[model samples]
Target: MADRVGEQLGNYRLVRLLGQGGFAEVYLGEHIYLGTAAAIKVLYAKLASDDFEHFRKEARTIARLVHPHIVRVLDYGIEGTTPFLVVDYAPNGTLRTRHPKGVPVPLPTVVSYVTQIAEALQYAHDQKVIHRDVKPENVLFGRRNEVLLSDFGIALVAMTSNYRSTQGMQDMAGTIAYMAPEQIQAQAETASDQYSLAVVTYELLSGARPFQGAFTEVAVKHTLVPPPSLREKLPMISADVEAVEMKALAKDPKQRFVDVQTFAAALEEASRNASSRTTFLGDIPVSQEQGASFSPETIVLSQQEAQEVSPTALFTTPDVAQQPSTDELLADKPATAAMITPAFEQKEAVEAVEAVNTPVLKEKETTALTSQPPHKGISRRAVLVGLAGAAIVGVVGGGIALLTHPLGSQTAIQPGNVPPGTNGGTLYTFRGHSGWVWSVGWSPNGARIASGSGDATAQVWDATSGGHLIVYSGHSDSVYGVAWSPDRKRVASGGFDKTVQIWDATFGDHYYTYHGHSGWVWAVAWSPGGKHVASAGQDTTVQVWDSANGRHANTYRGHSGFVHAVAWSPDGKRIASASSDGTVQVWDAVTGVRLYTYEPYFTDIWSVAWSPDGKRIASASDDKTVQVWDALDGSHLYIYTGHTDFVYAVAWSPDGKYIASAGDDKTVQVWSAIDGTLVYTYRGHTAGVRSVGWAPDGKRITSGSWDETVQVWKME
Candidate 1:
């Protein structure tokens, strides 16, 4: 294999053999003048087709995709009788390395890897590209734990192929360890890829293939035997997680995950019970790569890369040469930390020791360590050279660290700019709000939405197929909060007139009213379990109410000022509220006991909400900032300072990817809660936006403003 490579084939020259698999051999190659390294896979000579049809088939399948997870095909054509493919060569190697010594990985690690690969499969399956060979070796890792699915040489395109099946008819194609049972019998569907994924996950978690023995035995076992229960092998595994694994590993493809997306989501839900010990690995590194060729037809740099590349005389036009050639941009990737050592040699150690003895402080600390002061001990020139070399290494190493780094960058939004089309005029303004629309909420089914206005009316509308639903009339003064119950069977509305009203979710018929507050009612929330409800108001109190009966079970008061917002924790065990006195308070809803208060200087609090999982609370304030706090201890997590005016309302995305805030600046901003990175700003309202709410499906956001118009934004 090594001898055959490095030989010229077609218009390309293979540099060296990288790796050889069952059906093809990967070679490191460089496009003549592009100065970049690329991996080309040549089908084994005996297996190569006499005609070039398979190469075209694989290229066509790859050409239809532009996903971050799927490996990119730079170019493809026949080289003699051998069908070859050129794909991205991930520096970190395969998913197989994730289990060296054949040890089963940690459950969390297994979950993370499987989730990513499943997402890749889901993407390919959506494009009607069946990998046909889903195995550990095909999933490659890039600079930041980034996952790239490769080896599309045998990908089955759903194009005019008569071999494609609507129903199962057994077929054998993938590696036995990760192959679906149906595939062993030559019956495959998009579901076969999902089954193979489940087997990969099983290997990751248990460190052994489900059917392990001779190849023939494993093949037979897959057709007739059930996998040993994961819980039996790993007693520490949760029953929920084990059950999910069993479902994914079902012998019949139909019994397995319906698709990769469904499988990934199920894994997420099953693993939701994890605690602090569970390690969180975010997005695997994903990047767009071009072949060694630098021509326009072959390369496309991402937006960030476009900004970083500067011009040179050799490459005249910026639009043409601004992007670095593939090798230059990717050459910075470094080895994993697990593979590096910490100690330094004596000569290098001496230099660092000498630099510390200098003036001790430089205007720039980072750049100061590279030289010795006039008074320093030891050989001055030697010390300077060593430290300079060390500094160079440090800077280069840092860049590499960033390359393979797996954490996804958060969306960054400019302060007050409207998100694209949301800029100039109101898309559609509802005119019924006689007074300020204090809060707005979309129905669970998304067919309708309800708004609480100062006119003491809870107005409902058909979100789509636009029309008015009903005007729920009961409160006397300003209605403060309106929410659609989880089941969408009921709607809860609170008002300044000291009343909490329940209405029929669809018909808007007034059901029952509970009288509780002494002053203005500020907010109302239904518990996640849907059995009970909680209300907070100007009475400086929080009340727990019975949804079944129009009765207040408990009233808890602790805020020195009016309680503006109330939200039930995901577990239904606690409640969080923001008060006018610049403090966010957490309470035990059952015991009516205050848990903690998040006090940050002299900023008055405006609104507060718990994340879907209840791990954190996002509080908007008069301080012109939104502060994320730990729900348990009230410790500050992140302070979002993009709002130019007082922040009036804040809400968490259902998926928790972002936190949306509305403020007196007449702008609404969506921010990544994990890192306080702003995604987009919505600025069409002519007056202060009083409230913001995420739609149930999380595809859109609704904002109620003093401008008297309810604006709905589409989150892209």
Candidate 2:
């Protein structure tokens, strides 16, 4: 089809051509009256004069599937024997736009996207509709960032078999990279879509398609060879996850999961069971530590062998007449009208006035198909919550289930008894890290946050906008701890690299490296005066050093095992360290003298926090409790038994009225500082909560998690 810009068909005027594919020419279109924009997919196939009604009839069946995820077929018709389908315009482009080819998406995000796509496919299957082309290019995004599955127009031909050749239904109809074995044989069914989705999942996780090479090689591999293990690409991925992927990628359609929904749910269950610390993906699922690449566009094959076919091979054959040489304006009457209404349509009257609401589609062309992941149905809650204790049942029908699934009924927190006045929910998420975000600290001004991740990088980013400011990648291994200076100008981060690094918060310039720890450095804290930094490590020591120079001031070897955390008292006169020695040791800051040790319980302590008033101390312990005690006498006060697993992080509110604790249960709970009763329990992270900090304004909090995200939420 030639460039059809300036052509008017029904209510739409083709504005600019967006992309040219082997199947259709997609143009950015504007409605004449409503002024709404759409992607006008003008397909170039010579529909015989008598076959026009059959084309319209098959198109109507596809249009009837009105779903949030499925791209809407706003209207379709033939203009002088040319078939064109109008659909919703996705301004944000596709998933390929956000995360390009071979890019590593976070595991949590991958599961969520696949879940949304599965829901859409399940719904379409109910309508007996099978999308022949489920590749990335056909997945689009709406203006609201909703996943809109496109190109069901291909399904029209696949189901009705009108546009196929004399070889019968053996004509290849989809992108070769994601085609299932059955699809290669022209036997595409609903189960075949599930297989293709598994290929997509495999690509998303391992950053490469299961079968790669030329079309012929890939087609043969898809038929005979088994997919490479995802574990080979990402060793950190759990065996259960790899097994689920393999089951879905089975060469035989009958060996695969019953549907797309079951495969997605099984993947989710496997991901949760894997260690959040590993799945947080600091070690991305890439075969190599390099950038991304693209995929093949379209491939057509005969029943026996592969062959090149033009976009109009099915229509331009001898049975059909060639289209007119020059383009022609649409007829006054539409080829389809009142009789071809949508099946489950809900007209968005407000959405019709979006001519100026979105940026015009950029005039760009690509040979490869784009990608779009479905976004609705899978929310932050759904990502974190799955109340299946023993197993996650994918379906009551024939589906797969995991015996020891990570998704299960979580413990509920009782009503909090703390001071009331904070609005609490997730406000923003820091998603730059590829693996687990182990530590996070709010800047003194509450405007930014510093995070350390398993990606061996410490980053500074805006707390509200989630914008990156700086990424300090000097660490040689996973960065386990990070803290901002009191002035908010510098940061200190220590990790498995066994050294404490000081750097400029604004530009990520390295200032000093304290090479005093023999083992992994797990925690770092700045003094109230900002002159000294205290670093705790697996070497069983708390080393206080000069922040400006790589000079150590004191080494407090006060524990029998590794020191997990360190905190400076508000007065800066004392340092408190929590250790695997099963104690919270409070000692003098200047001298390596231990003042007192709080060991009321025989469990290891992971985190220690000083009260804002410097009158008390709190410690998170491995016994699933947060212990609060007197800073002066080390007398036990009250214990919070809220978490169902080991408590990892603890922080006091700026006002000293409330305390927050994060635990392996994947929750950040706020409680009364006076009596240790629950105030609020935040269940937004999909993995274990590793670190917690309060904003200087006292209205918000930031928590790092094994889910590889730093979530900032408002509490007032």
Candidate 3:
């Protein structure tokens, strides 16, 4: 095999031998014309001569089993009596190489790989082909971490010639440890493949094989002994998952799972349930009492209320007769120890009270409220008098204010009182970036806005006052994306320096720099729980890393072109990445397994944002459109074609009713997220708008532009 390293077999030039077994040698081969790499498995000359028909049959069987999870047989031929089969090359090596000794892989990752392999086996079984040899060594990974089931050399085709007898008793096919009880009796079937897969799954979860010994001993155990419980080896393995594995490893073929898909689905469900129980819920510590009282039904109802009410309803003034006194409202809402302060400076306390009392609208109630003529009876002075009275009462009551104040009292500046910078509803224009402001994001509390710039810095500014608060100046190159951690104490920024930097939100102190990306980092998004940050880059990969210590967690590499933007689902379980490959892919954040790819656009997709509820994703592309689609299945829900040029940014409103997008059109357009109807357009920036973000209050949007300004405004 070593001497034939440079030998030419048909159109393939063998680079080196990848591996070798008793019957065949696997070589790394390159196509002479296309320079594409392939794994060429060549049968030993002696074996080829004795089983030429069987070797050809193996090739035909693999060629017919075409699926994404199954390795494709590209070409096959006999060269001087040595038959060879060419299959897709997997650069990442095999599952055995990735997990050599039973090292416990992450639960999500174990389930993901098992489900993929099972699906592939189900497809092969549907074609009446039983992979007689099913083990981790035969499961290969492509460069993008795509799982491919390879080595169909020992597969059995229904009604085909029996080759097991020709090999004789000396060379019983399949790895002894993974063989099913029936397979040991030379009665291999689809169920036999299921049993072998169960062994692989068990090994992946617990990092140990079910039964281990010498070849003869292991074979005897497979035929006569029941497999050990996975939980016994790894107590963390849930009982449900162990049952799934044990059921698939049933001694009798008929007692095993009817199909590989059923077993895979069961394992996946168990994994998800376990993950949900252990998922991080963020920095907000919940006491046992609070956690016990948390009702998912109440949360759902709140979300529904938010989604149904117009954004205006949030600010609608109650009838004077229905209005509760400020003292009564404050008395009903007791301040927690976290919210109470001993020394209350009136000026600072007023600001704190206003911040604390500001209502963060529910996700469902984000739509623009029905436009109604203002009440002509109540004078503006009377409204101001009411707010002033509330402020005085708040001071007397130690900084406790009514939570639901009229919209007039909430926003200091009214909608029609447009500020300078050529806009109708502009509240403030922040001018500090020396170059283009590439991205803008609002803190969870809507208190601060962060913007990344070509100036090689990210600046955090007060959202309402437009006052510069902190300047993060560490990146050596232009900063592209900025995100606020869910706790609002940390900020994450990605830049042209091929790095992601986490810094203190208030003091501008650098926390850590993540340098895992090989290409310029384009976007950074904090997970909803604030524990991890997902970053996209020109390297065609999306990486999730620990926000605390900058530890690289996982890398997702399915995109063929540069990944421009990444966003986390609200639940923090899934991530969505938009790429120059013209696709938006939603993947598991923990497992790095791709879930869905949305490719409605034919040109580059520049940005992606998940809906507040995580049900949909909105993508902005160079195709001059912003598209909203189902996040789980990639079904196109709506397309906003109002932009005339490349749309660079897309953001879903915190309330979930609207989407704001900006691009080369030099304008920021707000459209109904539900039906893609045009809500309003802000044409304030002189240069193209690069990024836009929704204020946490759900009342305003802030847009950063190449014009070197960040404009905060509201839709009237």
In terms of TM-score, the best-performing candidate is 2
Order by lDDT, highest first: 2, 3, 1
TM-score of each: 0.41, 0.46, 0.43
Give lDDT per model, in order.
0.62, 0.68, 0.67
lDDT, candidate 1, at 486:
84
For model 3, residues 537-591, the per-residue Cα lDDT tens digits are: 8677889888889888999999876688898888989888988777888888899
Which regions in candidate 3 have their CA more than 4 angstroms from the true location?
A: 1-422
Best candidate per lDDT, number?
Answer: 2
What are the root-mean-square deviations of the candidates from the true structure over C-alphas?
28.2, 26.4, 28.7
Name model 1 segments beyond 4 Å from true: 1-427
Q: Sort every candidate by TM-score, greatest first.
A: 2, 3, 1
Poorest lDDT segment (10 consecutive residues) of candidate 3 = 391-400
Give the CA lDDT, 0 to 100, for residue 131 in model 3. 78
Per-residue C-alpha lDDT of model 1 across residues 655-694, encoded as one tens digit per residue: 9989999886678888898998888878767666889888
Number of clashes in model 1? 15
Please report how far candidate 2 places residue 547 from its true position, in Å. Answer: 1.0
